[model samples]
Target: MDVGLLLLSAAVLIGAVVLTATSGDRRIARLDRRLARVEQKLDAIAAGVGVELPEPELGHVKALLAEGKKIQAVRAYREATGADLKEAAQAIDQLGT
Candidate 1:
């Protein structure tokens, strides 16, 4: 292929990637907002019913951290809190610090 044709093809590929990423980001952001609203509503309902959310126990996770087993700590945190992988990892990292 000619240099000009190759350059055009590359530009098109890059544009497609950018478009896909942008749309995906927007969709994720939208979902996050929706989730926040739902959580707020749930919180209000819980408060109205005098229902209290219990704090998750992280003793095992802390023990794992003390043993220098970060991955296992994250796993334990996730199991304890039902947090996603990233949230669990971040929480474990914060505890380590």
Candidate 2:
């Protein structure tokens, strides 16, 4: 009975390790794809709006987005630059990449 329990515990541990490794890889891939999309959107906005941004402002926007404050960042950008929410989000997204 003790041997059976030890085998079961070992199997469970191995399963857990495999699951953890796969999940981490999937998360990284998802983040990369998201960053790519954000970069594309940012480029489109820059071309369409013709708004030139300095480096510091871009960094702040990127930080806000990374912290998951998307709406707040968009609103702040709008208030600061008089750009609309969509435009601000695009600018912020661009900063993230």
lDDT of 1 by residue, 1-97 (tens): 6999999999999999999999999999999999999999999999999999889988999999999999999998998999999999999989999
Q: On a 0 to 1 TM-score scale, where does candidate 2 land against the true structure?
A: 0.48
lDDT (Cα, 0-100) at 81 in candidate 2: 73
Error of 1 at 74 (Å): 2.4
Worst 10 residues of 1 by lDDT: 53-62
Query: Candidate 1: misplaced stretches above 4 Å?
Result: 1-3, 85-97
* lDDT (tens digit, per residue) of candidate 2 on 1-97: 9999999999999999999999999999999999889989998999899977654354565567789998877777777677777888888777567
Q: Where does candidate 2 stray beyond 4 Å?
A: 52-97
Superposed Cα RMSD, model 1: 2.9
Question: What TM-scores do the predictions have?
Answer: 0.69, 0.48
Candidate 1 residue pairs that clash: none
